[model samples]
Target: MKKWLKYSLISLVILLLIGTSWFTYTFFIKEYETADENVDNIVDTDFEVELPDTLEGDLLDKNESTDKNVNQSKNESTKNQNSQGNNKETSTRNKEQRDTENDNSKSTNSKTQTKDNNKETKNQTSNKNELTKENDNDDQTVNNSPDESTNSEEESEKTQQDHVTAEDIKNRYRPTFQALQDQALAKLNNLVAYAYSEYKKKKENGEKVSYGYFYKKYKSAAKELEAKTDATFERLYTSLQQDLVENGYSKDEASDVKAYYNQKKDERESRMLSKVLDKF
Candidate 1:
């Protein structure tokens, strides 16, 4: 039994060793070699996965779209920032412009006020000058007032004296002028009566003497007498005017008296002419 046991043990040991050797060779060496060959095939051959044509285009498009979205987002953010900056700049510029306009307005107002003040000052000065001139004129008028009054009184007295003298001269000469006027009127009446008597005698004698013819003859003789009377009166008036001038009466006053007497003569002659017509 001992000897059999020893032989059996030896056999078991040998089997176990063989099994171990087989396992090492199959698992370690063969598997390792196979995995190494697979790695080499993956490197050498085209072993990368290949996508379909449509899937590849879609993927590329998707990637491009994503990149575009990212760029657009970045651009939008930048634009927003730029717009904000522009708004800030615009606000600042507007504020500055308002300040500048305010300053200019204030300056213009100040200048206008200064000009108005200067003009007002000039007006005041002109008014003062005008007042001074008016005062000077008033003073000059005051100084000359007495002399002017004296001259006016002297002239008035002279005019009164001359009027009194003219009245005296006219009174002194009136009687002589009346005599001449009465004498001339008497002559005119005599001539008118004579003419009427002659016309009546001719008609009574049936001598065919028209009253008009007798009236014409009477007018001719009366005209001659009137001419002589006028000549005499003219000479007498000339002498009277000369005497009046010598006696301090003006020639104009003497002429007025002559005109009065001549009007009286005309009245007397017209009355005489009316009486002669009535007789006819």
Candidate 2:
């Protein structure tokens, strides 16, 4: 029995040892497997963490590129705006310059036209002055005609030694010429008196002499007076001629003197006639 008991105890010990070894091996192996699995899981977790950082870096780079593109767009837009503004300023300046030039051209044209107008006015004024001078010359010519005629007659008389001067005629035969002139004047006065009386009588009789009556009577009276005046002057001229011959004057000189006396007498008669017509 003691031997069986010892064997049984040894068997129990062996079984226990086997069980312990199995348990130890199982525990160690299982622990080693778990450590390997943990290592794998840690590697996977590290890979996941690094993947997120790479994605973040890529996003930051893309953001920087976008910023650069935005900045470039802003610069391009500013340059375009500046160019537009410069072009507009240039256009405005050109317009102003053109306007100023046009104004200057217009002013020049106006000044030139004014100068031309002034020249025309001056020419017209000069023409008028010339015309006035011509008119003045004509008037002078007309006024000098009588003096020229008298001068020519005096020159002819100067050629003769026996030509009677005005002083000589006044001292020598003035009384005779005066007596004859008075006689003629007295006759003309008497005719004027008769015409006045007739005009007064007709007016008082209420026969306001019509134009025909007045004209006919004046014409007849003028004719009678002219005939009487001519006859008286002829007698006086004949007497003067005879006296000039007695005074040692040539016939031609005597005739010329008589002609001068007759011309002066005729001028006096014309003045008297003008006065009479004015009264009528």
Candidate 3:
């Protein structure tokens, strides 16, 4: 019985030890496999997060390049518009300058034509006056001629009288005529001097001067001188005619003397006017 009991106990102890060993081995193997699986999942999640970030960075760089290209294109377009505007402005200015020059040229041409017309008119007027004076002289000679028989003796006397000449007539009238001419010229000179002085004063002050003002002043002076000279000649003629009548000359002889004096006076006036014109 003792031997059977001991044997049973030993068997029981062996069974218990075997069971403990199997449990420990199975737990250790399961824990190792679970830890390896967890490590693999962590590595795959890290790789997924990193790949998205890199893709986002590449997209941002592409957008930036597109924006830069768009900005460059806009700048080029603006520069082209400015260049066209400058060209148009330059063309417009040139056209305006050309038009101004053309207008000035036309104005100059018109002024030249007007001056030529004025000169031609003056020449025609002078010719007409000469023709009129010649006609008057011919009429006077015709009216003065006497009958043929008396004309021969009268002609010889007339030849002797005419031989007294323009020089003799000029000598007789020169002193009185020169005095009147000198007076007129002195007045004219004074007027011209005054006008010029006034014009210069106004010009210095930056004022405009009109040609009409100068012309009117000159006309007034000329008219006053003409009136005074006409009155003097009339008085002289009346006095001389009265003297001839008082001396008991025949009507015809007194008339002839009066006519010769009148002719001399006209010639003297012409010479004086010539001198005045020369001074002008």
Q: Among these predicted structures, which one has the highest lDDT?
A: 1
Clash count of each predicted structure: 0, 0, 0
CA-lDDT, candidates in order: 0.61, 0.54, 0.50
lDDT per residue (tens digit) for residues 1-280 in model 2: 9999999999999999998887665543323212223222322221111101222344356556555655565565556556655655665576567557655665778666776656655765676577556556655655565455456445543434244443453344445555555555555555555556666778899986544444444445555555655665566556555544655654454565466557856865686577567656
Better of 2 and 3 by TM-score: 2
Writing each residue's lDDT as its tens digit, candidate 3 over 1-280 gives 9999999999999999997776655443223212223222322221111101222354356556555655565565556556655655665576567557655665787676766655655765675577556545644544443233244444554454344433333344335544554554454455455556666777899987654454454444545555665565555445444443443433343354446545755664565456445544
Model 2 segments beyond 4 Å from truth?
1-171, 246-248
The C-alpha TM-scores of every prediction are 0.40, 0.34, 0.29
What ordering of candidates by lDDT runs from best to worst? Answer: 1, 2, 3
How many clashes does the backbone of model 3 have?
0
List, residue by residue over 68-183, the lDDT tens digit for candidate 1.
65556556555655665565566557656755765566577876677665665576567657755655665565556545545654555455445445566566566666766767
lDDT of 2 at 98: 58
Residue pairs in candidate 3 whose N, alpha carbon or C atoms collide under 3 angstroms: none
